[model samples]
Structure formats: C-alpha cells, structure tokens
Target: MTQPSSEKINDNTSFQAFVPAVSRWLAWQCEMISEVKIGTVFLRSNTANNNLKMFASWPENVSDSIEGKLYDLAQDVIDGKNNIMPKMTCDAGQGDMVYDTTTLPLHYNNKVVGAVIFLQSVRSEDQKKAVFQLFQWGCALLESTLTDMYEEQHKFHPLVTDLAKLALQDAPVALIGHQICNLLAQQLGCKRVVLGTMQGLQVHTLALSNQLRFDTRASHISEMEAVMEEALDQDQAILYPKSEEMFSSVTQKHQTLSADNEDASLLTIPFSNAENAIGAILLLRPRNNPFTKEEVKAVQYATQLLGSSFSLKLRDEYSFLNLLVQSFKKKTQPVFGTGHL
Candidate 1:
C-alpha cells in the first residue's frame, strides 16, 4: 500500500448537483460476491484539485480508511498510464489481514470521473477473477446512477448550487450550519430558520440565522425546539399544514406549536444518514405564503441530498490522523470533535 500523500483533496460540492436515485439512507446497498468484501469508491472529479475525495464506499470501512494504494492505482487508470481495465491492482497482507484489490476506472463522456475498487480477503487468482466479473456488473449499475445525477446537476436551481458550495466549504460545522440556515431562509423566503440536532432528550440549537447567539431560555426558541423534538421522536418530517395526516399522538406537540406561534407556517424536517436522524430544520414562513405540496417535496428532497453531503464534509473535517491513532479503525465511528481538513 502507498503511504499517505500531502495532496490537498478537493472539497467538491457536486453532490448537490445530482439528486440520488434513491436515498442513501434507505437503500445503502452493499453486496458481497462470494467471500470478497467488494468496495466501490466514487471520487469527486471535475473540480480544481484532481485528488479524489470519496463519494460513497461499500463495506462502509473503506469510506473511513485511506486506501492509498487503491486510490493511487485508480488514479493511474484515470491518467491513461494504466489502460488495462479490471486488473488486480494490489495483493498484500498485514499480519493476519489480507487485502486483494482490483481497480476499474469509470469514464463518462470519454473522461474518467471516478473509479471502482474491488477488494477481497482471498489472494487466489481464481477468486480475484470472480470478484472482477461481479464488480463489473456493479460498475454498470453505479455508472448509470452517476450519469443520471450528472444530467440532473445541469438542471439544478441556483440555490441547489449554493447549497453545494456550503456543503463543500472548508468551514467549521457550526459555521456550515449557520450558512445552511441562512441560505434556506434567504432563497426559500422563509421568515426565519432554526437548525439544530438532538442532544439526549432535548434539541441542541446549532444556528439561528437572525440571532447570532441562541437564547435557550426564550419561549419561542424552546417551543420550536420542542416541535423539532416531536419530528425527531417520530422519525419523519412534520409540517404544520399536515398535522392532521399524522397519528394523534404525534399531532399534539405540532398543534400546540402552531397554536402558540400563530400565522407563521412552521415545518420541521429531519436530517438523516444511512442509520438514523442526526438533526432537524425548522422553517418559518409568512402567514400569507402557505407551503405548496411542490414546496414540501422540494424541501424533503433537498434535505435528502444534503444529509449525505453534510456527512461527507463533516468526516472530511475530522482528523484522519486521529483515526490512524485509533488503531486503524475498519469501521468509522460517528466522528465528532473536530479539526480542519
């Protein structure tokens, strides 16, 4: 395996350009071909920096660990220096752990946008061939999805593009949270935006675009946070207009929030990843500007796109060196406590 490089990775926000075919949180499909734990890494291309940043990874651990050798080989495939397609890139072992890897470059419009890497535990030539064939099919499926996403990027709204920039920026999480809320309030024409995530049973406010410092004791802030908690507790987006559509048990807090804060259209949507709800956003719009179904759908879709982008940016900001220090973690833990990328 190649040693880690000092190359600056591109913080490509292109993920927002493409609406994923299926929510990654829903169908985070990672398949195994035989005993081989194949990993397909989609790197962000078409950015200023050529160095690849992971888009999605299979076997999950591959997303966190720096697969220098695999990435380097994939880079070679993209550079046209290694034209041989679907070849075993590396066969190595460390202690009892063996990693037999192969690289296949994914090209679009005659340009290599990303690469697929298949890694198996067995070092046998016969097994490597099987993994290659299986990975080829996987590549076909992935490439189709990427092509659709690439096409969708060109049609995305200006706000979507701006959201991409916010996601890619090398900024602190709190700053990013502020930017997201500010952008939502500005472009979406909401009265205000409250962004936060749950801490224990209570919601922890991250950013209030209009208010620099969160007033935890404020009655309105506490009520909005309660509405956020209601949505998170139910694991779904809660729109004040659609309160009647929800279970009666779920409707009480939403009803109370709306009653207390009359006129403003309140909506809270959960920000989730592959596992569970990580955070929520409460958008307050003017009384006259009632939300349309189209608007609701757009908001849901935007959050879906954002959840993955935010997760990647967050991990990018996390210390890979810290992970290296943590005994070469195979599976990434929920990385919090930060440093700059």
Candidate 2:
C-alpha cells in the first residue's frame, strides 16, 4: 500500500526507550483518520549498521516489525536524499486485504533520522492529505508526552523515588494509606493529608497525617469527606479555590472549608485502578503554603500506581487483607466498616 507521503525532532535519547503512551497515540491516530485506517509505524535507523528498522507500530503487524528495506523510496527518505514522501497502496492482512501506506521522513538537525509510516484502506488523495495532517498532531502529542516522561525520570528526586517505593511495597491498605498520608504531608509541606477509602459507597476517613486524634464529626472533617468522595465518584484530581473548573458538591464543600480555614488550599486525587475509584487523598495546605501545579501533577501520577495497588489488595486480599482488617478491628475498632457504609 502506498501514493501519498509527507512531513521534527528534538532530544538525544536513544529511540529504544519508547514512550508507553505512544502505543495509545498510534491507536488514536487510527481512529481519527477520515479513511479506513490500517496502522502506523515509527521507523528508526540502526546506529551500528545504519540499517533501517521498525522502532514501533500500532495495530501490531508482524510484517512491519520485520527488518527489511521495503522500498528504495523509503530508504531514500531516511537517508536525507529523497525530498518526495513515498505513498502507495498494497494488499495487506490475512485472506487478501488491501491498505494504503504513506511514508514521511522525520528530520532532526537537518538530518533524516527516522520516518513515520501510515497505512489505511486506499482512499482519495484528499483523504491522504487529511490523514497526513492528523498524523502530525499525533506526533506532536507523542513528543510532548515523551519529553515530559523524560524530564520526570531525569529529575529523580528522593521524594519521588521514596513515593514509588512506598506505593510498590507489600503492605496492608490501611498501613499504606497511613504511610502515604505521612509521606505527602512531609514531602509537600501539607498541614494535613487525609486518606479516605471508598468502602462500599460512602467514603471513610482511614488515616490522617501526624495526628492520632481528630473529631470524626468535625465540620472540617465533613468537608474533607465531601470533597474526597466527589473526587472518587467522578474519578478526577481536583484543585480547590476554584480554578477553571465547574461547581460541584465537592467544589462547594471545598469553598466552604476554605472560608472556614482561612482560604487554605486543597488538592484531592482519586485513587482508581482504571476500573473504579477505591479511595482518594486530600492534601490541605495553609494559606501561604499553596500546592503548585508541578507538585499536584507529580502526586496525581504517583497515585496511578498506588491506586492500582490499593485496588488489587482491596479485591484480591486473601490472607493478608483479611488479617489486616481483623487486626484493625481488634486495635482501633474499625472506624466505619464497609458494612456500615
């Protein structure tokens, strides 16, 4: 498959470490195309031999994964010689399927370092042009996400590593919640971080940082519960003090809490395993200690792993979870059993 072809670069990182989101981005590109999309591949050159190889492909095709010079035109584009992008249509898929493929060179420092190959059902040249444009948008997003991931890894802050270790540890959910609250409070300069778990439907305040005693029926606690539950119910991370977001029950509670606490800021991130939210974390900062966007984003990403772990333990805890629950009951008398919720 081929007739149309078309189309940056940055960074010095090896192409071997591809971004995980690129896979999703590929699938998304397949969806947005105005034609029947076949697949897309990012081809990179092997530095050792200067031979072209498939770096990654979407909708997985074994043929694309193979090491081969499919065409001289593609090789020419990769070699910084041919300026015309290659495009063609060919038979693909099992039982005689057909597809249109377009190869566009990706340049870096005026050198052709890689190429993007797009495939779909043979369509009008106009459709090919539209797809070419859409593909560019996908590439831009891919680049941004990869750069973000790279910067995050390069930073490698101690707190970030420690948070990762904490999330990955084998521990009871209650203990994990308590430790996470404490860790966030210390790392982010939060006055308090209340870890709340969605037991059945209602949210239960499982742990609070630094404090051993707090009123369960306190107005502030009620607001926290409301805000946390809202986040979990909606499965979103929210920043209080009303940014460019809508007014929900959680937002309203946050506004009330802010007024009472001298406009203290709040950041609530729901803990979900991609299926459903199991809990949430509410970070409370004093007036002068507002949470930054970077800090909020870092905590939100950290919760992705932590939330999955929590959900896994919540649903599949055989002995450890059961023992933990029993122990909690024996010790603190179960602050609101899921049954009570």
Candidate 3:
C-alpha cells in the first residue's frame, strides 16, 4: 500500500481524522464482500467532564452499551499484552452474540491514547482464522491512514487557517499574492512553486521559488508565456508527467526540484472564484511521481476557500474606499468648507 508522505504529526488531529477514515474503510470493505454481515470500531476517551464517553458503532447501529463493553475488552488486551482476540461474547440489543474481535490502540507519541475494537460475527474455526488475518491487515492500514491524515492536516491546516485570517484584511493585491506563494512553497509536497498572474496582454510570474530560475532566452520565454496563457484561458489544472522533458530545452535552475535535486514533475493548479482566473499554483513533485487525486482535491478545496476569502476582503475594502471618497466630496462642498466666502 502507498503510505502517507512524511511531513509532521498532531496526535489528536490524527486521531480525529483516523477514526473517520477507518470507519469509512470498514464500510467499504463490507461492501466489497458477502457473508461479512457486520463490522465496527469502538473508541473511549475521558471527556472534559471526567466522564468516559463511548464513541462506537456497528455499521448502521450506534449503540449506548459500547463504552462499557469496549472498556472491559481493552483492559483485557492491555493486561495480557496480546494484539488479537477471538470468540468474545457481548450483549447486543439485549441478546448475547459471539463477536470475532481484534483490538489496536490509538498511539499518540508512542503512548496509547485509546483502543480500537474491530468486530464481526464468528461462525467456524476456519472462518475465524481468515477474519483474524483480515483484522491484522486492517490494523496496519489504520496506522498508515492515521499517520498520513495527521501529517497532511498538520502541514496544510496552518496555511489554510492563516489564509482565512488574512483574507479579512485590506492589503495590496501584490502583497497578498506574495504571502500566498510563500506559504504554498513551504507547505505543499513539492520542492519548488510558482505563482502566476495574467495581465491584459501578458502573463506574469508573480512569484517563484528562490532556488529555481526562468529562462529569459527568446524561445523558452515565449513557450512559458504560451503554456501559462493556455492554463489561464482554459481555466484548468495542468500536470506535467515529465517536467524536464516538458521544458527539456530549459535550464535545470528553472525547473522543479526533487529530493535528489533532480528536475520534478510540475502541476499548475488554477485558482479562481466565480469571476475568472485569479491565479495558478505551480507545484513540483518527485520526478517519477505526481500529485494523487486526494492531494489535488485538497489543494482545490484550499484554493476555493482562498479565492472566496480574497473576494470578500476586496469588496469590503472597495466599499470603505468609496465611503471615504463620498465623505471627502461632501466636506469640500461650498456650504461646508467654503465658510470664509
């Protein structure tokens, strides 16, 4: 399985995203097969009131008894130092049912924050063994999913939050553009990034990474202008699978950077509100790998948020400026300011 990119960690944030990701995965797994009638993940945490809350479910049913049952099972697993459980019986809706089980703890900074209980119905010995193996795999999957979700959230959350805050301010357009470019370069899963804008008849590179260069050479400059304009005119994102080949004739200093310092694949993600193209985000990924669908989707959502915020701020500033002008006009009127005459 493809693991999450290494970025950073936020334990609570990771757990938040992890819980939902695991639940969705369980749902998907059940849909993919037959005979697996039910599945669930149960969690327990001490809330602010010092009461232990049960956040548990079995596919469609979110039962109230899950907290106590899971707390008991969790203690058993921790005390025995075992990773797997089988033939556990628990009350469900006032009746007894044998539940095949596997439990994993949510790790936070190498400490267990909570326990994950994976459950399904038990039938035969062979069936139980197969189910156990599947649950083990699920544990590994959950670990990877949680780690990635946390890292991604950690890396982008600040940027998005900052953008939302900044969008309320009245600032010069050039300044806002520069700040956005800087954040994208530092946060996005890429070595280099560029911010581009379209003028009346020319496309301009608003910002580029400090390490990269752009060819001022006649041939490539025209080509770069053409590529940028196409992206703006079409209002679509562009992904260059082989960025070096795409701009093969251009110099290395101007291309995207990879871990080994090689030229990287490039992605030009367009950002616009309801009006038109505001700008495009240029990102560089590893030479052979490109942005995944999920990453792209995330960036798209961020862009929309940024665009909407920018639009609102601009409208407010313009209104303020108009008010100031009207006030000045009134103050300069003959009756108000020409008192000496």
Candidate 4:
C-alpha cells in the first residue's frame, strides 16, 4: 500500500485526497472475496467536528438503503458497541437481493476513530469468518494511516506551545525575541539563532541567541540580515547547502553567509501576517547536521505565532508612544502659550 505523503497528511484537504486511493485498494481486496458485495469507508472529518463522513464507497452506484445501513453500522463501531455481526440478512433492493453487513472500527492510540463496513451476500459460517478477518486487516492498515496523520499534525505542538508561552510574557518585544531565539536554539540544536523583524523593505536584526547585545553593523550581522532578506524577498523558506530540488530559490546570500561561517548549514524561514512579510528567523548548525523537514516545519509554525505576537507588541508600543507625545504636548501648551512661545 502506498502510504500518504507526510506533506499531504499534514493538511486536511490533501489528506482527504488520498483516502480514495486507500478505499480503491480496499475495494479491490474485497472483490477478491466473491461474497463481499460492497465496501465503504467512513472517517471523522476534521472540518466537521465529531461528524463521520463517507470518505469512499466502492462501485459508486450503491443503493441508498445499503449506504444508510453501512453508516449505521459504522457509527455503532465508533460508539464502542460490539461488532454488528450478520445476525440476519435483509433485502438491500426491491428484489430478493439479500445482504449481511459487518463493520470494524479503525483505531488510533487505542481509541476508535473511524470504521470500515462491508456488505456481503449470504455465506456459510467459514466464509463469514474469512470476510471478517479481511475487514480487520483493512482496518489495521487504515488505523496505521490515521496514526501517521495524527502524529504529523501534532509533532510540533510542544515547541509551538513553549514559544507561545514565552511570547505571551509581559516583556519588551526585543526581550521576547531574545527568549524565542534562545528557546529555538536549545530545542532545535542550532549553534546560533537570529530573529529579525522587517522594517519597511529591510530586515533589522532584533535578537541573537545567547548574546545579550551585539553591534548591528558587524559584518556577520550584515550577512545574516542579507540572508533573511533573501528569503523574505522570495517569500519562502530557504535552506542553504540547497537541495537538488531547490535550484530555483535564490540562495546567493545564504551561500555567502554559510561559506563565511565554516560552511554551516543555514535555514531561513520568513513569517508574515495578513498584509505582508513581517519577520524572519535564521538558524545555523554544523554542515553535517543539516535541518530536516520536520524541524523546518516546527520552526515555521513557531515563527507564525511569534510574528503575530511581535506585531501586536509593536502596535502597542506605537500607540503608547503616541499617547506620550500627546501628553507632553498638553503639558507644554500651558508654558509655551499654545504656539506663540
């Protein structure tokens, strides 16, 4: 079976796109069993909380009666009920076409999350047992898929949560930026991490991990700013020692920065708000310890949260400064005689 791609599973719509393929495979497997008439798969839709939607149905022309019955059986399985065995056969159509239904719940972390249902013609006891076993195996494959999807979606929750808590602290934006850099460096095992916020079209370095202060005009800092601008300009993540697949991304500044620093592996991810690019994060580590897809994704998520926090803090600072200016004007108006002094 072709497993769902990591990138697809991380997205709900893309994940659904692969369900039909899995259902097709399961339908083919069921066709091997002559007694099995129809196979349907139901999964909990992330878009609709707690609602189980029909992900795929084989033959594409199943009667409404059969589909409704299958949905009921699937719901039963998800509700922790006993497997609804073939207690009796019922007419699925107007004619004497009788069928028995069976459902198996798909589990992830030992909790029922979805189900697979099969409608089969009347068969002997042994035949029924074989069909049930096949359904069980199919459910196992689906369970494994669900587990992978769930893990991929949440693998960065801890990192994001930690960064969010730090960002929420009542501190200056620069101090918060420094704390974020320090946390990211420790979590991601980077030799250094730099945070920069976009000012007009240029990126100004805000904080560097493990350093209380540094000269902004330093050559190394300038190179780092250039690297961030390279990513912000392209509006995409850039990983230096660029992969063969990333030939289109302009990484000239990244290459220079990495070459100047012992050929270190460098990653720059730009974060933006609704308007435009707001900030970027640059991480550096040894060349041998290149960043992985998972690490890049985690940082991307973290940067999004950080960007919003920083924007809000900066806005607040601007508002406070305006209030202070107005207060000073009011205090000086009495002494200055309102523009005559």
Candidate 5:
C-alpha cells in the first residue's frame, strides 16, 4: 500500500496516527477503480471544527498543481454539492495528461463528514457515468466503515462510562434494568426499550422504558418477549426490516412485532456471560428510522457491561438462607439427594 505524503494541511496531532490507517484504506479503495489515475480524501478534524484536512492521496506523490485542484474540488463537496465534474490537464513525463475529476461527499448520521475526489483518464460520456457510479459506491462503503471505526475509537469510552455508572448505582436489580432500558431508548432514539432476562429456558421481560407497570399477559408484552426469545435462541442480535447483511438470521418474530406496532423498526440484542446468554434488549423506533450499525454496537456493549452485574444483583436479592441452602445443595449433590435439598 502506498503511504500518504507527510505534507498535510491543518495537521492535528490527534489524527496523526489515526489518519494513516484511513489513508491506506482509502488508497486501496481508490486503486480498485481501474480508471482512476489519482484519488484523494479530505476529512473533518472534528464535528465542531469544519476545517477539512487532506487525509489520503493515492500514488503517494503528485504535483502541487494537481493536489491544489483536488483540494478545491473536495472543498466544493464539503459545501454540500452532490457531485462535481471538471476537466483538467496535468503534465506527466510523456506529455499533457488529460483527466476528468469527480467528487462526492461522505456522510455519517446524515451529516457530511468528509469528501473524496477521483481523477480518471478522460473517457466517453457513458464511461464517465460509469466511473461516477463507482465513485458513489466507493463513498457508501467508506461511510459505513468510517462510522464504525469512529464510534469504536471515540464513542466507546463515553458509552461504557455511562452504562457502568448505571450498573454501579445503589438500586435494586429491577430498577437498574428499568434505568438501562430508559437510558438506551433515550440514547438510541428509540420510542421504546425492553429488557428481559432468561428464566429457565424462557425469557421474562423485567423492565420497559417509560412504563412503571404493564400487564404481563398483554399482547404487546408477549410480542416483545417473543422477539427477545428469537434473538436469544439464535444467540445473536437481530434487526427488524432486516438488511441484506442479516439474511442468515431468522427475523420472523421481529417482523411480526414491527408490523403490529405500526410497522416500527426493531432491534433485539442478546447479552451473555461466559456460560450463556443471560438477557436480551429490544429497541423500537419509527419505521423510517432504522438502527445504524453504531447504535447496534453500543447496545451490545451495554449488555456486556451490565449483564454480569445484573446477574449478581439478582443473586443478592435472594434471601441469605436461600442462597446458603442452594450453595450447600450444590456442594452436597453427589453425597445427598437432589430434590429441593
């Protein structure tokens, strides 16, 4: 893989080490476009800072004039242009090299976070359209990958801290579950959130966000449990209105639940300990608002952070004699009968 040039504009120490990996990935992606002679990407320093800095450039070396042109095109992309096409000529060793350039903006959570510019050899109108289509596809892939990476690197710490703090609160296990459900619903923009724990082979709903009491036998409650059980049975997260990427996992229950609830989008994540899955969380939002990969990951992380803590709390809820008797029964099972001690 080619390395980016050291000459960076608006260089920030925070992104110094981070930029290279992105640069390499972008370089590789650009190389995939057979017609592209040069490619460059520019990314925002941070959400608060609108400054776009050169992140990566293919070929590792390019004339200053070519770099300047790409930078201008990238700026235009950042300014909200959907697409820009321009013709330019650069002198290669042989002679004047004519190229056609295309630029596209990259978005995360509906916000433009970066831009990519590609320079392809001049071609016919149809061929240029094909190259443009390739650029759009490349931008989509880049956005998805970048979103996951950015969340893992920058958002994980805050998510862990917030969930861990909730787990540490001096509260009952049921109340803690309620808090977690509410927190996740609020954080993930879900209209409702439900938390359920595995009891024997069945998952029991422990808490529902924004609701102090709900009928255990209610139709919606049962539907929610069914969705949770579906995910727990498979031991994997399930997203409703399922994406093509999740085709292997069955989502019938999730679909039914969503359909019954005004076609809302749904996501169920089962969290487990070392032995097996202990509980699952279900999040629901409007049908138009699907869960993003980052939000799904955040919920998965929350379950990992809180699953064992909730299990321990539930154990502590048992009477001292009950726990002691259970422990004794386990210890003496080989020597004595196993029927309720």
Candidate 6:
C-alpha cells in the first residue's frame, strides 16, 4: 500500500516542514562525525480529544516500537513525565545490530504536542554525543515548526484542556505536596517522581512514586536544595539529563541515563505556591528524550493548578466542594501504598 503523502515529505507545503529542518540539523551533525545515519523522524500527534496518535515515521527503515511499553513511554512524554532514551536496535536485513535512539519531546505552547525520534546506527562515544546534540537541535527546530503549525491551525485551548487533571483534598498540606509530585511523574512520563520539603533551611525528602522507591535517606537533601536554589535563581524549568555526571563530583548518589538503561531522563520542577517553594516535583523517563518547552509548560500549569487547589483547601473547610477538588488530587497521588499522607 502506498504511504500517506504526509508521511515524511518535509516540503514547505507539507504539514510538517519540521522533518527537513531536522534532517538539515542531523546532516550538519553527521558532518561533525563520520558515523551517523540520519534516522527517521516520528511525530506523535494529539487530536481534539487529547488522545495521542503516533504519525508515520521518515526513512521507513526505522521501525517503530510504539506498541506496548514503548507506547506507554510515548504517553509519558506526551503527559510530560518521560526521561528514558529509547533504543533503536533492529534486524538490518542482514542481522541484528545496535543503533542509538535519540528522541526529543515536542510541544505547542505549554502542552506536549508530540515528539521527534531519531535512530543512529553508531556506537562510538563521541558519535553518540554528536547524535544527542542533534536531537536537542531537532527540538529547537520542532519548536519553531510548532509555532507555525499553531498559527496555521490556531487551536490551542483544547490542547491545554487535554492535560490530565489532579484531585485535591484538605487532608494536609503534606498530602497535597505528595500528590503533586505524583502528578508531575504521571505528566512528565518519568519512572519515579519525588517531592522534597523544606524545614527551616534544611530540605527533607517528603514523598516519591512507588516505581522509583528511592531511599530519601540515601541522598543528601543538600544536593536537592542546591538544585532548587539554582532553579529559583534561573526562574525556569531545569533539565538534568545526566544527573550522575553533573552531581557525581558532589559525592551524591546520582542517576545516569545510559544506552542500555531503561530510564532516560531526570527532571526537577520547583514547587512554589503563591508564597515560596515548599519543595520540588521530580519526574523520570526511560526514553532518551529531553523534555520539550510545551511539556515544561504543561508541567508548570499542572503545578499551578495544584497550587490553586491547595490554596482553596487552606481557605475553606473540607466540605463537599473541597472533597471534589481533593478527589482530583487523589487521582494523581499514590496514596494506596505509602500511607504518609
């Protein structure tokens, strides 16, 4: 069967001119390194219902693993909680070979619109970094493309509305904090998300998703505190692609993303209400893709929604109205196991 005309044609008239731009970036990257194949570019679309659909990929040689676990990973990236770098190994007619997969989360406004996935059949360490850098460049190109797409389509309200909602409760401020962390995990497509609380000048680990199950005791809160301080100073979302490498010098047990490792990325979203940053919401992903600006905005909006809900709870009693909001918070939190809240 003939593929859809929209498949991989990156023409000016094509719905996605982003592909050619990405190809140009990849080509430039390949020039920098000899062993790089400009792999296919995959687009994950979010229709009017907020449901995600993976569009056909470029090159056609790169097969999509977006069926089971990979599909879930894509969802996480769309929800804004993914940090895992997906692998690109496939049977190359001749035999099975290793291919490095690099992915970048795509967004329009503050919502995750889709992603661009690249597969490079190179193993050299330097080549891998060059390919990774190309992915980051693709992200930038995709961002510009999205701005054009949004202008042409001019529909963004439904996109933001499709973002998952959280349940809020007047159980306790700590409970709200815990649930917010989980929501960040769910939205960001990370394996685990943790919340750290500030007590005086010291920050304490408050909550984490069950999937991660990291020992707060194992980490020094000072490290997290330092990260948050940096985020606050920057006044923006911070991405920690190689936590282990950056924080390794600081003597903290940091997590790193490897080609073999399933989890791909680590994210820290500073959780400051109208007042101050009570703590931060962390996210995890196993696919090798950095969070997109749209994904970041979705996360920031979700945190703002949670903060608003928390503020409402602080003002009123646990009446039916409050319970309604709290239930939304519960949907995002993992209150079933760790009975801390």
Candidate with top TM-score is 4
- In order, what lDDT does every prediction score? 0.60, 0.63, 0.53, 0.73, 0.73, 0.49
Report the Cα lDDT for residue 129, model 6: 48
Q: How would you encode candidate 6's per-residue C-alpha lDDT over 50-123 as one tens digit per residue?
A: 44444433333344443333355556666666566556455534366665666567755444556555545665
Model 5 weakest 10-residue run by lDDT? 1-10
Off by over 4 Å in 3: 1-159, 166-168, 210-225, 242-263, 311-341
List residue ranges in candidate 1 displaced over 4 A: 1-154, 243-249, 309-341
State the lDDT of candidate 2 residue by residue for 116-149, as single tens digits: 6665667565445444544554454455444445
| Local distance difference test, candidate 6 | 0.49
Residues 263-287 of candidate 5 have per-residue lDDT tens digits of: 9999888876545677898999999
Per-residue CA lDDT of model 1 for 75-167, tens digit only, reads: 776676755444343433333355566677775434567676666665455434433543454455445454545344333345554664564
Global fold similarity of model 2 (TM-score): 0.51
Q: Candidate 2: lDDT over CA atoms? A: 0.63
**Candidate 4 runs further than 4 Å off:** 1-156, 245-247, 333-341
lDDT, candidate 3, 164-241, per-residue tens: 334333465556666665666666666666666555655666555553345544453444445566556656666565
Structure candidate 1, residue pairs in collision: none
lDDT of 4 by residue, 188-306 (tens): 88999999998988999999999969999998998899999999999888988887645379989998888888999999999865456788999999999999877776677667656
